[model samples]
Target: MDPINKEGTPKTPTVIFDADKGKVEIRGRSIPENSIEFYKPLVDWLDRYADEAKGNTEVNIQLEYFNTSSSKCILDVFKKLEAVHKKEGREVVINWYYEEDDEDMLEAGEDYQSILKIPFKMIEIQE
Candidate 1:
């Protein structure tokens, strides 16, 4: 399947979903006016990717900030990944990168880790 490569604007994040490489990445701020609309294609791509998924899928999420609406959409994306791991029995690893001084981002990663069954690696990066 073709990958989704979206450039980040002030209101959105850069998204890179490459099924061939079994890698997905989202970086930058996510505060789109319509979160669902902005994230729908990615969700759909995941649905299709589940059919022909790789042995191991790596997800890298590096976000500086996200609004309330984007949070739910982010969770939805994770849920899709969870299904790939659980129902499909595919290996999925999430790398949640947060700046060293960003407590909120670290906590957000923790919260998602607590909620999702997939393994998450909390990576602390220099600001």
Candidate 2:
């Protein structure tokens, strides 16, 4: 399947969903006006990828900020990956990166980790 790549704008995030590389990354801010529209394709792609997933899949999420709607969309993305990990029996790893000083981001990662069954690594980087 073709990969999904979108450049980040001030209101959105940069998305790189490369199935061939078994890597999916979402970086930058995610405060799109319509989060559902912005993330639908990503969710769809993950659904398709679940059917023919290869080795371990690594998901890197580094968001400086995101709105409430975007948060739900992000959860949808995680849920899709969870399906792959649970129902499909694929190894899915989530690396949630945040700046050392960003307590909100750290807590956000922890919250998601608590809600999802997938393994998540909270990576702290120097700001």
Best candidate, TM-score-wise?
2
Question: What RMSD value applies to candidate 1?
Answer: 1.1
| TM-scores of all candidate predictions against the true structure | 0.96, 0.96
* Candidate 2 accuracy as TM-score: 0.96
Question: Candidate 2's residue-wise lDDT over 12-109, tens digit each?
Answer: 99999998998999999998889999999999999999997887799999999999999999999999999888854579999999998999999999
Worst 10 residues of 1 by lDDT: 82-91
Model 1 lDDT tens row, 16-125: 99998999999999998899999999999999988879678999999999999999999999999998988555899999999998999999999999999999999999
